[model samples]
Each structure stands twice: as C-alpha cells, then as structure tokens.
Target chain A: MPSTTSTRPGGRSARVRAAVHHAVEELLSENPAEAVTLPLIAARAGVHPTTVYRRWGSLAELLSEVATSRFSGDIVVPDSGSLREDLERWAIDVSTDLSDPDTVALMRATLGSAAEGGCACVGDRHAQLDAMLERERSRGGKAPGVQTAADALLSPLYYRALFTTEPMEPGWVRGLVRNLLR
Target chain B: MPSTTSTRPGGRSARVRAAVHHAVEELLSENPAEAVTLPLIAARAGVHPTTVYRRWGSLAELLSEVATSRFSGDIVVPDSGSLREDLERWAIDVSTDLSDPDTVALMRATLGSAAEGGCACVGDRHAQLDAMLERERSRGGKAPGVQTAADALLSPLYYRALFTTEPMEPGWVRGLVRNLLR
Candidate 1:
C-alpha cells in the first residue's frame, strides 16, 4: 500500500484526492453521515466511481481521511503563560469551530460513523484533545489527567453543541476554564 | 388533536400504542434510525402502516415520543439530601443508561435527527435534564444553572458515548460528580 497519490504537490493524483475531499465536505454540508454514499461522492467530485472505490474502500475510510485533513490545523495550543488564559482561548477556539455549520455537520458525521459504523478514526479526535491537554501540562498547567481534563475542558462545548439549543458564549468558555483550573 | 388512545387501563388503543412502542424499540435495536421506516415498524408491531403514519407524522416525531416515554421514569432524584451523592447517583444512572445498547442506539438516532433533520423534539431531552437539575436545586443544593449543570454532570458521558472508545465506568462518574461539585 504505497501512496496512490504522488509525493509532489499539485500532481494529478493529488488533485484527485483534493477533489474527493471537497466533494465529501459538500455532501456533508447538506446531508448527514448515513446519507453520504461513494457514488454520490464520486459523481460530485467528477471522479470515476471505480477510482473512488479503489482509493477508498468504504465511506468510513473516506470520511476519516477528510476529517483528519480538514481539522488537523484547526487547534493549536496557546502559550499565554497562564493556564487560565490558554485554556480559555483554546476552549473558545474549539467552541467557534464546533459552532460553524460545516464543522457541526462534520461532528455529526464523525459521531454518527463512530456510533453506527464503529469507525476507529474517532480516536483521531481524542488524540487531538490529548495532545492539546498534554501541551498545557508540559507548560506547568496543574490540570487533572488527560482524560479527565478532556471531560472538564472540552465536554461542555460538545455537550451544548450537540444536545442543547443553548448558546456557547465567550463568558461560558471563560467559566469553563476557571472551573477546570480550580 | 384529541386523545387518540383512551385513558382507561389496558384499553384497545393503549395496547396499540404499546405494541407500536415495543416495535420501535425492537427495530431500533437492529437498525439505525434512518433505516427504520413506518412500514417496517407497522409490520413488526402487527399493525397497519397507515396507523403508524396517522398516529405519528414522521420518524423523528415517533422516535421522540418513544424516547421520552421510556426515559421519563428512569431517573428519580434521590433524597440522599447531599448534592454530591445525588449528582453521583444521577451520573451513574446516566452512565448505565448510555452503556445499555438500546439506549445508546436511541441516543445516536435522536442525535442524528437533531443534527440533520432539524428535529424539534430534542428539546424533550433538555427538559428532562432541566427537571432533574431543578429537583436538586429545590432540595437546597447549590449548583450551577440547569443548563450548565447538565454540561457538568452529563456532557462527559455523552461525549464518550458518541465520540470515543472510552468506557464510561462508575469510577469516572464519581470523579465527574466530585469535580462538578467542587
């Protein structure tokens, strides 16, 4: 399983990957996870259905690739010198991302995949959370364990984002950071 | 709309509703929400598809009805009088519910509806959460607002339930309660 796409930037194969990725985003914007199919994605991307099938064996694999590539640069740990400020900024950043319609669609898609398809790519999200928390701990933040810290700092944003109609305001993010720090 | 079913105990219409409800649970156990349709439910319940359609306008409405009726009686706020104990019990109860395969399936389904279908019945779950929190507050427990309390108390269970492979253990529930209370 060597790279199907070229290592060089802007190559023909790379263009295919990019097209497929954009097609996924477009489909997810309008439909939930269960509604997205390989044929539709291929048609939207203007790629051959056989190419999509060969390149991505299943919908879960394609979604995982798209989610990882799209969100990998979304979160960056802040070094504000104070744990409170760093946590607040990080929480707000994540909140903003979650609040975006496209991002919310992605969240729904990934969570749906995890729940129904048992997709292992869900670990990517937890890994991102762990890396963010680990950075804070390295900078002398006195937070709980990585898992617990994730529950404290990140769960609320996701909770509201998914379950409730309540707004995820900036002040609430500040409160979350203060509570987690305390 | 007047009552489609009589209030009398074990009436004909009551039996019909019960059969339909059980059919929904059974179908959801084997399939995702989108896969469960009115005809399938009617056939499984030994009723007519038109009956289900007339009784419940859409799948989201029907699922919401089933979820609300089923879970309304599941959580009873304990009078242990201590907010810490009460919160821990509630969290564990929710953890156990999330661990149950049927409940998790239902959660995924309803969340799917909320995320994709713009289902309004998602408010039913928040109402249950608020009622539980108000009970604790009425008992002299000094906690955060109901929405925030739901975030602190229940969000982590859902986060792990929907997002990651993490086990929502009893110990973690205790820890969540302790942190939220502190």
Candidate 2:
C-alpha cells in the first residue's frame, strides 16, 4: 500500500494507466450492457476523472487503446511446429475470445465513429499473424500472406462477431485453416 | 410536384418517407464525415424534424432502415449460369460497392451500438445468398450452404471494410470465391 517510485518506474502514472485499462476490461466483461462513461471508468480505476480526459481525450480513443493493449499484451500468437496446426489453433482461440458478448461489445465499441486509419488492433493482429507466419517459414513451411490470413483465418470470426448473431458453427475455424494451406 | 392519394396510394406520407431516406443516403454518402443529425437530415429532406423523430425514433434506427433497403432493393443477387461465377461476381460487386468511402461509412454507421440481434442488413444478405444458392441447387450445381457463403464470400470484405484500412486488394474477391468452390 505504501510503495515508492523505486519499485514502479514512472511512479503513479504507469500504475494509473494499467488500473484504468484493467477497470475497463472488468467493467465491460461484467456487464456489456452497462453504459461505460469516463467518470464511471475513473471511479472504478480509482484515478481522477481529469487524469483520464487528459490522458485518453475521448471514450472512443480510450476504448481503442484498451482493445489494442488487449490484443498486443493479453493474447499470445500461436507457434505450433506446423503452420496448419498453428493457424488452426490461433483461429479457434480468436473465435473463442470473440464468442464472449463482452469481447464483442468491446470490439464494436472500438469501431463505428470516424474511420480514421481504422483501429490499432488491426495492425496488432497483422503483426501477430506475421509472427506466426514467420515461424512457419522458418520451419520450411508454406503459408499464404498476412492478407490471406486476414482474409481467410481472422476475417470470418471478426465479421461474425461484429455483424451476425451466430459467432461460430462447429468446425468452422478448422475449415478456414484448411483453406489457406490448400 | 403535385400528387394525389389516388395516384400515390399513401400519398404525402410515402413521399416523406422516401425523401427522408434519400436524404440520409445522400448525407451519409456525399459527405460521410458530416455530423448527421435529425435536424440536418430533415432540412435536407424537406421534412419536419418531428416527423422524422415520430417515425424512426433515432438516428441508428433510421440508418439501419436505410441500409436494409439498400441491400434488399438496390443490389441484385448475381445470377450467372455457374455457382462459382455467380458467387464470384457477387463478391466483386460487393467489393466494388464497399470500395466507395460513402458506402463504407454507411455500413460502419449501422453498427457500434447495442448488438440488438445484430443488424437487419444481415437478414437481407442471408436471403439473397439463399436465393443464389437455391438457383445453384436447382441447376444441379454444387454449392455450400448460406453459412459458408457468409464466411468465405462476404465476411472477408466486411472485415476489411470495418476493421482494416485496406479494404479490397486486386483479385482478392475472386480468391475468396475460389476457396469456396474448391
């Protein structure tokens, strides 16, 4: 409870940032229907409201940042020995993560305002897919481009989670993995 | 323009509805960056603000309805002799339509709120896909179900449009069609 700046670099600033993001994720996952406001998020985060506004500017950007950090930090890119197995496992993982209503709400929240360069999570996913594909190629495996992975592997899951009522049918993710390999 | 109840059935009421929808489409497509409001749309449509509010209730609902009509009425389900060709053509058409910044904005505007049964445009698309697939089956042409068409054919495009900055690459739509046919 009584920590100094020595243990935590950037002192309270970094801790506050982490706390805000964690609070957002918890609030979203607990009740996707809850109207998430800056004040509410600040209260839950135990940070001043002014700090959030000064830091993130708007709720959309805050949500985008939270979503981006989630993709980059929370989830791990699969690195199975085989390209097919790796992509299949990755797709299933993505589908499972997106199947949650909270994640879907978070995803939807990140979009729909101004399409200024799209979301940061996309670039994050691309880097992730690139990492997976790079591992495959290093192992003397054949794989399609990142765009193909975006098209074949990840797009269907995101599209369903954002647009349709049905997220994933049985064996849906595996079929996508099979397509790129073929 | 002069109209009568005998000539236009619903007369002024139908005309007002059409005008408001046309206004929304124009405002959304012509300048997607415009801050679309009931007053703004009403002024453009030459209708009373109260009328729009009374009829549609909210901008999201209005946008959703306009999007539904565009999918259901404007776009035709491609009908080539072959299922592969038909699906490919349809995919290309969708890619082209969504290639427009206005259409992308319109599509994005339809989402990002409460995921109440997703969007109505989805139902319209499913119906169109079903119609196309039914024709293929009748002609003894093999085709996947509506779900497959959604995942392989449409999902990638929508995913790119909403999530990624790069929408459709050259020959990308055709590649999606190829995956399903094989």
Candidate 3:
C-alpha cells in the first residue's frame, strides 16, 4: 500500500511531499537505482524512515511516486489536424521524456524490480498511459489503427534509451512517426 | 573480460561451459536479477569458483554469455519477396524469443546490470542488430525507407516484451508489421 495520507493539517503536508519527491528525483539522478535505499532516501529528504514509510508504504511505492511525479507537469497533446503531425508532436514529447537520463534510470530500476518481484508501479504506468490514450481517443482525433500506431510511435524511443548507450534524438522520433504513419 | 577461453580444452571443458550456462539460466529464471550471484551460479553449475572466474571475469560477464548463448541460434531471415513479410517474420521470431520466461529474466538481469555499470553486452546486441540491418539494406530487398521502417517494424514488439507481464503472441508481431507497413 502507498502512503497517500497527508501528515500535517493541509498545505504544509503538500510542501513536505513535494520536498521528499524532489529529493528522490535528485538522488535517482545521481545514483544507480540499485543503490537507492530507505536510509539514503530518508537522509536526503531530511525526514525519518518512519515518515517515508508512513507516506509511501515501501521503498517501491515511494519510487513509484517519484517516477510518476516527474511527468506531472504539462503534457504535450497533438492536434495539428493531421494524424501525422499529431503523432510526430506526441512522439517528440514522449521521446524527450524517455531520453532523459534520470527518467531512463528510474524506469530501468522500476522495470528491474518488476522483473524481480512484479512491481505494482508498472501497472500504474500502464493505467496512466491508458487514461491518456483514452482521452486522445475520446477527442475527435482518430487514426486508422491508433493503438498499434501509438505503440509504434513511442516504443523505439524507450528501446533506444534503455538498450543502446547512445541518447535518442527527436529526429529519430520524427522519423519513426513518419515511417509508421506514412 | 569475459571468460570465453578455458586453459584446458577437452570434452570436460565443453561440458563445464554448458553446465555453467544452464545453471545461470536456471538461477535467472528462479530468482530475480538481484538474487543471482557468483557462488550460487557455481553451486548450481556444479563447478568450482575458480572455474567460474576463469570462464567469465565477473558475474556481469557471465550473464552476458548466458544471454548471448540464449540468442545464439541463427536468425531466420525471411525471403518471402516482400519487405513487410520479411520484417513480420523477424518480429515474430524476436517476440517469441523475448516472451520466454527465461529470456525475460535474462533481459531484466542484463538491463539491470546495464543501468548499474553500463554492460558491454548491450553493445554486442546493437552490433548484431546493425549487422543484420546492413545485410538487409545491401540485399536491396526491403521497401523504400528501410531503416526507419525497420525501427518502426521491430521496436514495438521488443518494447511490449520488455514492459508487459503478459506473454507476447505471434499475432501481436503480425499486427505491428501490418500497421507499421500500412
């Protein structure tokens, strides 16, 4: 179970959560995923282990919170009146996010844990993606085969990011979108 | 350096390598990537630590050998006179290999090590892929925009295989091929 409850009386709790989330991101950026431990997170967050546990339940849950939080900012949606244009813009955004070193590291860590013992966080990612896709589908935007097209639009960025040592560029994402939707 | 060469060469040597590889695969299948260890691999393989060390420099190197061996079979390059058919066949092959429980475990372990210390084996996988692409390009059997098309054709299967807990089906590969090529 995740610790979603606010410890303090209202606005102050949000600040604490934000601080902890930021610290987790910073630590994940600097260290390998395997190196992150409860003690390190607590030390970096300037909080006690119990507090983190109370909030996020386990280290996996906390990491999931941090992972999801990184993408909580503005999401890019494509609406260029052309499916190609829409997909290209969306692909670029997804590619950029996947290419980020911190994002890649966190994903690898999460996936590694999933491989080990089935991380519940991966389900969260899927649900988030499904919701976003549902939103897109509900809109007037429709492709001939959107699900497969979307997978084609997004998978390469992640594959290159995770497997290859080189960073994936926006050009590759654009090329991928062009080839898939052409 | 990976321990590909043993000081003694004979039937026993071949058996030892085979035993070690099998052991590594079994351990990977049974345990999470983090739980796999040199001592455990040795015990499972029925070999001494010295032999394990002599065969592979480190656990990472040994695991790389295991992954390589698992994928060592000849790539079934299709020649059905159409680029789409060829690519679909390739995708099915890759999807089948990736969907295996052992293969998934190996991939998790490989990516985990890659995230931690930058596994050299990833370069090997890329080199193999590049070589295959180069061969196809030289053969001139593929359609226009072969490189981009190839990425679009194959990336989705690999991505789904890696991220999803469900086993990838041959139909999924076929759909990816049809959708990308359409």
Candidate 4:
C-alpha cells in the first residue's frame, strides 16, 4: 500500500519516466527509425517493457510526451512587452531548436499522427502566441491576430525545418517580424 | 526498333503512365495508406508491378511524380501584370489545391522521404515563384525575392494544409498577400 503511494517526486516513478524519456530521445537521435520499438526503448532505459506500456501505452504517446515536455515546458516564451521583440525572439528560438537533428526527427514522427487533428507542437505554439498577443492587447499595443502571427512567423520556421534544406538566415527572423508588424 | 520510342504521346507507355497515376490518385483518396504498395497500385491500374517498379523505381519516386504533375504542370502560376495580383492568385490557387484530401495524403508520404533533400513539391513551388519573380523584375516591378515569396506565401498554405484543421479562410488569403507585400 505504501509502495503504491510512493510514485511521488524524485521517487521510483519519476526516475522511470526520466529514464524512458532519455532512452526515447537517444534512440530517436541515434538514427532514422528502422522501427524504434517499445521493447527497444525499454531495454535502453533498463525499465521493464510492461512498465513503459502500462504508463505511456504506445510509442506515439511516448514520443509525444518527450516532444510536449520540450515544446510546452522547456522552451521559454518571451514577454519583453513589445510584440515585435517578443515574436522575433520567439521565432529565432524556434528556428534554433528545430535546427537540432533530434527535433527534426521527432517532428517527422509526430507529423503523421498529427495530420488528422493538427500538430500538438503547433497547438503549444499557438497557445504561447495567444498568451503573448493577449498581453499585448491588454497593454494597449497593436498586434496581429494569433493565426496571422502563426502564418507570418511560425509556419515559415516549421516549413523550413521540415521540408527545406536552407537554414533560417541570420537576422531574417527580425526582418520577418518587422515586415509583419509594419 | 520502333518499340523503344513507343513512349510517344498516347502510346502504350503514355497509357500506362496515365493509368498508374489515375490509380495512385484513386488509391490515395480511398484511404490513409496502410502501405500503398507498388503491387496494390499495379493491380489496380492493370499494369504489371514490375512496370511500376521499373518506371518509378520506388513508392517515394512514384508519389513525387503524382505531386509534381499537379503542382508544377497542372496548377498554373498566374501572371496578372501586377506582383500583388499574381501573388494573391497564386496563393489562393495553392490554398485551394492543398485542401483536397488526396494532396494531404500525398504530402504525408512525401514529407518522410523528403526530409533529407527537401520536398520536391517545395522545389516546384520555389521554381514557380522564381519564374514569376524574374518576370516581375524584367517588367521593372518591385517584388520580394523568391525565397521571401515562398516564405510569405507558399509556406503558410502548405503548413495549414498539412498541420491544421482550419480552412484557409476565404478573404484571409488576400489579406495575407497584402500584408506580406506591405
């Protein structure tokens, strides 16, 4: 009974979650998946397969967990009071983050499952952007609507990362922000 | 000896090509692929599987062919004598085309094989944009660079098509064009 309640912070459950996530990231980065499986990740993480299955339920969910952690939690959304400054910084951060091979890999996996309902990553970004835009409106500052901001700012970044070879050019994001807000 | 050149217009090779493409479009629209195999397509088209494999080499190449035929050749890039008008027309054309379920299915397939070198569909759009931009420059009309045009116009269309449920709003595309130009 005590052990059942022991799935607390820094406890065995926390350790398992962390280890599985680390293993998933490592496996995803190690190569384009020739089938990155639940058992493979479990073995890499040194947790029992059932533990991962019982907790995450599937590979897609596990991949999504890792992605959600990074996109929604780890990456900071800027709040510099100016919409242009905030958007430029945010776009640049996104471009930088997506430049990582692992992120690109994760996106490839998610985008398929994501196609039906829309990308969770996009939802997270849309939420972050909505908050920033709301703040700008409250401060009596002019800002584009969320969809406009997403189209002008975010879509290009994701499009480049997923579908094109070109890097997001230096200072281009600032220019995009300037052009958009103007 | 004449058989070698039988790929001429309306010949057996042309017929086969048409049939195969028709089959692919039909099959793609039929379902999210539980693996849209060469064999399945060949059977549907009444062409030999070897014919599909020989002509297209792989499923990825076949998918690209279907995509290229639509995006580059079928979908006309406009020339309205004004850069803004041309861009708006082109953007609206793209938004309309990608709204189809079949294109979405094709995109899902291409995006995976396309990750390393960039999507062929994107290349087609870039080339079309470049052609239009070059024409604008020749006419002494100021236009954004091809990459800028792609970022401003094409990326948003494809991004929303592939990654979101929201329809490309009726007048919103025109507004996007004006905003980007400004």
C-alpha TM-score for every candidate = 0.84, 0.84, 0.76, 0.84
> Residue-wise lDDT of candidate 1 within A1-182, one digit each (tens)?
24744665788788999999999899988875557889999999999999999988876678777877776665776776766676778788888887777876776665444335343323344565566567767877655566776787678887777666667899988987777777
* Second chain TM-score for model 3: 0.75
lDDT for residue A81 in candidate 3, whole number 0-100:
54
Judge candidate 3 at residue A126 and give its lDDT: 41
Ten-residue region with minimum lDDT total, candidate 2 chain B: B112-121
What docking tier does model 3 reach?
A: acceptable
> Which of the predicted structures, 1 or 4, would earn the higher DockQ when compared with the native?
4
For each candidate in the order shown, give its overall lDDT on alpha carbons: 0.72, 0.75, 0.65, 0.77
Q: Residues B20-106, candidate 2, lDDT per residue (tens digit)?
A: 989987887665332667899999999889999998997777878888877665568887688877777777877787778777777
Task: Give the candidates in order of DockQ, highest first.
Answer: 2, 4, 1, 3
Output the worst ten-in-a-row residue range by lDDT, candidate 4 chain B.
B109-118
Q: What share of the true interface contacts does candidate 1 keep?
A: 0.29
lDDT per residue as tens, model 1, B46-157: 9989988998887767877887777666666565766677677777877887777787777666655544433332334455556656777787766667666666777788
Query: Taking the tens digit of each residue's C-alpha lDDT, what string does model 3 give over A3-81?
Result: 6545544555777788788787788788766677777888887888888888777666776666556655435465555
Error of 3 at B1 (Å): 22
Measured with C-alpha atoms, the lDDT of residue A80 in candidate 1 is 68
Instruction: Provide DockQ values for all models, in the order shown.
Output: 0.39, 0.45, 0.38, 0.44
Model 4, DockQ value?
0.44
Pairs that clash in candidate 3: A3-A55, B3-B55
Off by over 4 Å in 4: A1-20, A37-66, B2-13, B47-57
